[model samples]
Target chain A: MARVEVPELPPDPTAATKVAELEVPPEIVAQTLGEYLRAWAARVRAGDSGVLPVIAGLAVITVVFQAISPHHVFLSALNLVNLLQQSAVFMVLAMAEGFVLLLGEIDLSVGYVAAVGGVIGVQLVQPATTRWPWWAAVVAALLACALIGAAQGTLITRLKLPSFVVTLAGFLIFNGVVLILLLLGPFSGYPSLLGDDTNRQVLYHLMWGTIDPLAGWIGMIVIVAGLGLALWLRDTRRRRSGLVAPPLGLTLLKIVLMAIVGLTVVAICNINRANIGTVAGVPWVIPIVLAVLGAWTVLLQRTSFGRYVYAIGGNPEAARRAGIKLASIRTWAFVICSFTAGIGGLLYASYLGGMSNNVNGGQLVLYAVAAAVIGGTSLFGGRGKVMHGALGGLVIGGIYNGMYLLGLDVQWQFIVTGLVLLSAVTIDALSRRGATTGSVAHV
Target chain B: MSDANVARAGAQPNAAAPPAGEARLQVRALGKHFGAVQALSDVDLDLPAGQVTALCGDNGAGKTVLTKCIAGIFQADQGQILWEGKPVHIRSPRDAAHLGIETVYQDLALADNLDIVQNMFLARERLRGGLLDEDAMERDAAETLASLRVTTVRSIRQPVGSLSGGQRQSVAVAKAVMWNSKLVLLDEPTAALGVVQTKMVLDLVRRLRDRGLAVMVISHNLNDVFEVADRIAVLYLGRMVIQDAASAFDRQRVVQYMTSGGTNGSG
Candidate 1:
C-alpha cells in the first residue's frame, strides 16, 4: 500500500502564509486613547466586562430600595454615610476573599477568625487585664489571623487537602475558638469588658471615629488627586516607552469618575444628619479601607508575587513549569486573606461596641464572599480585584441600609442578598462561557 | 550548575547521535513503568539543533509518556538523559528548564486571564525596583512574536484568553523560545487547531528550526509530520521502531509501522 508518488496536494499553504506580509496599520501602532477605549469596550462586550454589572446593580438597587420604601431618603446624605461606615469591614473582608477567589479557592474561616481576632484584640486591651496598647492589640489580632490562614493554606497546598474542607473545618474551629476564648480568655467579665469606656473607645474607634470637615475635604482632594496622578503617570510611562497605553482621555475619564464619587462621599459625610446639632465629617474607617485597597491593588497589579498568584490560579501546571513555587504563593494568599479578615474583625468589634458568643460570623463570611462576587470577582478565580470587593461591599451596605430604613426584617435582607449572589455567580458563568465561545465564534 | 558548566557540557553532543543538525538533547535506554504497565521502554531519541524531530505514534504508543520523561515530569526508571553531550539527571521540570529544555503542552499551558506578554513571561518576569517592568516585558514579548512571524495578534496587551487557537499555540511556542531554550518539546500543538491554524503553527516550528533550536514535535497526523518535520521517529508499543528522515516513509508505510510494529511496512 506504499504510495508510488509522494503526496503534493496540500500545496504548502503554510509557506505562502508565512511569506505574506501582515500589513499592520500605522494607526494601530499609534492608537489614541479614544481608539484604545473603543477596543476595550468591544473586548468587554465580548465578555470581559469588569465592574459594569456591579455599578448597574448598585444603581438599580438604590432606586428600587428608594421606591419600595415610603421614606424619600434612600439616597439621603445620612443613609449614604451610614452605608459607607457599614461597608468598611465587609469591603476589607471581600478584598481578602478576592485573593483566594482569584486562585480558585474559598476561605470559609475568615468570618469567625475575624471575630476571634477582634475578641483577642479586646482582651489584650482589657484595661486592668493584659492592658496592651490599642496598636499592639491590633497587631496581635492580625498576626493571629495570619497564622490561622497559614495553617489552613499549608494543609491545602502541601497536604493536598481540599480548600473547602480545610476552611470548613477552620470555620468551625475558629468559631469555637472565639466562644472558648470568650469563656476563658482575658476580659471574660462581660460588664468589665463592655462597661469600660477606654476598652470600648479603642475597639470601636475604627468603626465610630470621625474626622473634622476640613480634614475630610483635604483627604478627599488628596486621595482623588493622588489616584489621578498615579494613573496619569502610569499611562504616560507606557506611552513614552512606546507600549500600548490607554488613551489619556480614558485615564481622565476614570479619574473624573473617581473624583465625582469621592466628592459625593465627602459631601454626604459632611452633612449634619444628627437629631440635635451637627454630626458630620467622614468616618476614619473610610480612609482605613482606602489605604488597604490602595496597598492591595498595587501588590496585585504591580508586583511579581501578585502576578504569580493569578498565574497559579489560571494554570497551576504552567506556573509550576515556569519555576513558580505554587505552595508558597498559595499559602501567602490564604495568609493575606486571613490577615485582612483580622482587620474586618476589629472593625466589626468597633461597629458592635462589644463581642458576644453568638457573633453571627457565618453570616458575615457569606456577605464578604457575596460582596466580592457581586463586585465582579469570579468564583472561578483569575479574574478580580480589591476594588471589586470594595464596590460589592458598598452595594451590600446600600441594600442593608435602605431596607433597614424601610423597616424591613433581617429575613428580607437575607433573601435579597442570596438572590444577588446567585445573580452574580450566574453572570460570571455566562461571561466565562462567552469568553471561550466568543473567540471561537469569530473563527 | 554554573553557566560555564552548561556551556561546556552542552558543547559535547553524543558521538553516536544523529549525523545531522547539532544534537542538543539525547535520550538513551529510557524506560518508564506505571504499576505493572510498561508505559515506555528503552526509547532512544535525538533532538538535533536546527531540525524538527517529530515523534509519531498511534494512541497509547508511549508518545506522551516519553515526552513527560524528557520534560522531567516523570523520572525514567531506567535510562540516561544527555544534555549537550554530558549525561545529566533531570528529576523535575525545573531541572529540565535549567538544561534549556521547554515543553509546550497540548493545552498550550497558558493562563487565560493574563495578556500575551504576561503569559509569555509568567514566572520569569522582568523587574525594575522590585516591581514588574511592564514596558520591558511588553517590548520583549512583542519582539519575540515579531521574530517568530506571529503578526496576527491585535495587541500583545490583549489577554491570552482572547487569542485564536493558532495565535495561542504560537504564543505558547514563543514562550518556550523566548527564554533562549536550546530545546522545545511540543505535544500535539496542532491537535485542536483548524487547517489555517495548523499551517501557522507548522510554519512557526520551521522558523524555530531555522533559528537552530532543537525542537521535538509529537503528532498523530502524517500530513503535519511531513509539513514541518525534518525527521520522523515512529514508536510502537513502548519502543522506537523507526527513525529516519521524513521523506523515507509515506503515509501508508508510517501508518503500517504505527499499527502493526513491523519493519516491512516501509517503502
Candidate 2:
C-alpha cells in the first residue's frame, strides 16, 4: 500500500483560546438585548420558527373572525366565554394525544376512552346508584382509562405490534364499551350532572362554574408573580454561575409578555356574559386547563423521564443503547395519554351537562389530533410542548364559534379545520426536511 | 525483523510495549463460532493501560466479532477474560460497563435531537430533588470536552443533529471516557471522516492513551495504525496471525500477514 502524504492544515486560530470561547457560540454568549434579538432572528431564519407561526396564524384568525362575525359578536363576552368552555374539551384531549405524539406514536381511542371516563364519573355519582363522592368518581374514571392505556401500551411494546393498529382496534372496542356503559347506567341511557346534590353540583361546576371577579384577579396576580419570579431567579442564577442563559433583557421581556397575557385573560373573563342576569367571573375550566398545562410542561421539560421520551422518539435505537427502558417509557406514555383523555371526557360531559349516546367520539378524536398538529406539535415526534395543545384547541374553538356566528353549517367548519390541519402538517414536514439538510437548526 | 525494516517502522522503539503484568485487559484462548461457521478461533490479546492497540484486519477477518466479544455483545464460546488480573464473566453490555469497559460503536448511538450534554449523560443523568441537574451536567460535559481537546463544537447546548461528523465522534468518545472507563473499544472511528476530521479523531485517541486509558482502535487504514498505535494486532480469517509492538513490523509486513495469514508466503 502506498502512503499518501496529506498536506497539514494550519492551526485554527480559535483552538488556542479559552475553553469557554471555544465551546460556546457567539450568539449563545451574546451579552446584550440587541445581540440576543439578532441571534433569535438568525435562528428563525434557519427554520427554527418554534411557536411563531402558530401565534401569527392565531392573530390572523382572530382579526378575520372579528370582522366577518355577524354583529361582530365573535369577540363579545358571551360568545368568547362560550368559546372557552367549548375549547376546554379539545384542549385537554389534544394534550392527551401529545404524550404519545412526542413518542412518535398515536392513540386513536382517546375519544371514546374520554367518553368512558365521563360515563363512569357521572354514573358513580348518580343519586339512585353508587352515590360515590365526585372525587372518587373522577379517580375511578381516570384509573379505568389508565388501565385501558396500559393494556394497549403493553400490546404495542411487549408484543411488538404497531401502535397505529393497536390504537385503531382500541378505538372500535372503546366506542362499543362507551355505548354498553351508557346502556348499563341507572339513568335511561343518559347520565346527567344536573342535580341539587352537592357532589353532583361540584362535578358540574368543574367546567361551568366561575370564580368571583375579585378572586379571579387575585389568583391571576399571584400566579403571574410566582412564575415571573421563578423565571427571573433561575436565569439570574445560571448567568451568575457563568453558565449558558438568556440575556437579562430577554428574561424581562418574557415576564412582561406573561403578565400581559394573564391580564387580558382575567379582564375578559371578568366581563358579564349572561343575557338575563349578571354572570361574571373567570370560568373554573380556564384554571383547570392551565393547571394541566403547567404540570405537563414541567414533567416533560424538567424530568429525566421526559428526556428519555424525546430520545426514544428521535431514535429508539439510540435510546435503547443508552439503557433507557423502551417498553416502560412507551407504556407510561400511553397510560398518561389515556388518563389525560379521561380528564377531557369529564370536561365534555360537564360542558353538555350530560353524557349522551349522541356524543360524536369519532369526530372528537380527529379534532384532538388536528388541534395538536395546528398548535405546532410535530407529527414525527421528538418536538412539541403541552402549551401547543391549548393554543391549537383555541384555534379550533375560534373557527367553530366564528362559523356558527357567520351562520355557516358544521360541514364548512369541518372543511376549514381539515385544510388548516393539512397546512400545519406540511409545515412540520418541510421544517424537518430543512433541519436534515443543514439549512435549518432545531432549538 | 531486519535493521532496515525496524528503521522503516519509524523512530519509536519496541520499548513502547508495556510489561505483560501491566495489562488492564487480558484475553486468552478465546474461541467463538456460529452453528456452522467459525468467526473467531484461538485468539489471544493483551490490552495494557496507557497505550493504544490498533487492531488491523481485512473485511472478513473477524475484527468486529472479536471486538463484540470483548464488548460483551457476543459471548465467546471458550475463553477467560482477565480484568486487571482477575478473570470475569461479561454476559452483557452492562456487565462490561460495570467493569469499566465502554465501546464506541461505528454508528455512535447518539440521539440526534439531544444536545451534547444530554447525549453524554443520556441514561446516567444527575438529578437534584427529582429534577435533572442541567447545570451540573453541562459543566461536567464542557469540562470533559475541554480535557479531550475537542474544541470544534460551537456550543455544548446545540443539538447533535447540527454537529459535524468529527465533532459527533469526539462527543461519543468523550461520553465513553467520562464513565471512568479503563478500556475503550472504538470501531472505525474515522471511517466516514475526511482528512481533517480523521486527524481530529486520531488526536483524541492519542489523548485517551495519555490519560491512562486502554484504547483499542479497529481500523483498516495502515497509515492511521502506524501513526497512533503503540502496538499492532493483525487478524486474518478468524485467526490472529500477528500481534507485536508497532516498531516490530512495517506496513507491507502487516498487510502480508493480513492477506496471507502468514509472513512466509503461506496461508
User: Against the true structure, whose TM-score is highest?
Assistant: 2
Query: Which CAPRI quality tier does the interface of model 2 achieve?
Result: acceptable
lDDT of each: 0.81, 0.85
**Candidate 2 ranges with C-alpha deviation above 4 Å:** A1-29, A437-443, B1-15, B264-267
**lDDT by residue for model 2 (A1-443), tens:** 01122234334334322322322333455777898777666657766677777788778878998998888888888888899999999999999999899888999999999999999998889888889999999999999999999999999999989899999999999899888988775688998899999878988999889999999999999999999999999999988987778789989998999999999889999999888989999999999999999999988888998999988877787787777999999999999999999999999989989788998888888889889988888888887889998888888888777888898988998899889888888988887776632322222
> What TM-score should be assigned to candidate 2?
0.93
TM-score of chain A of 1: 0.89
Which portions of model 1 show Cα errors greater than 4 Å?
A: A1-48, A67-71, A185-200, A437-443, B1-22, B264-267
Top candidate, metric DockQ: 2
TM-score of chain A of each: 0.89, 0.92
Displacement of the residue A91 alpha carbon in candidate 2, Å: 1.7
TM-score of 1: 0.89
Interface RMSD value for candidate 2, one decimal? 9.6
| lDDT of model number 1 | 0.81
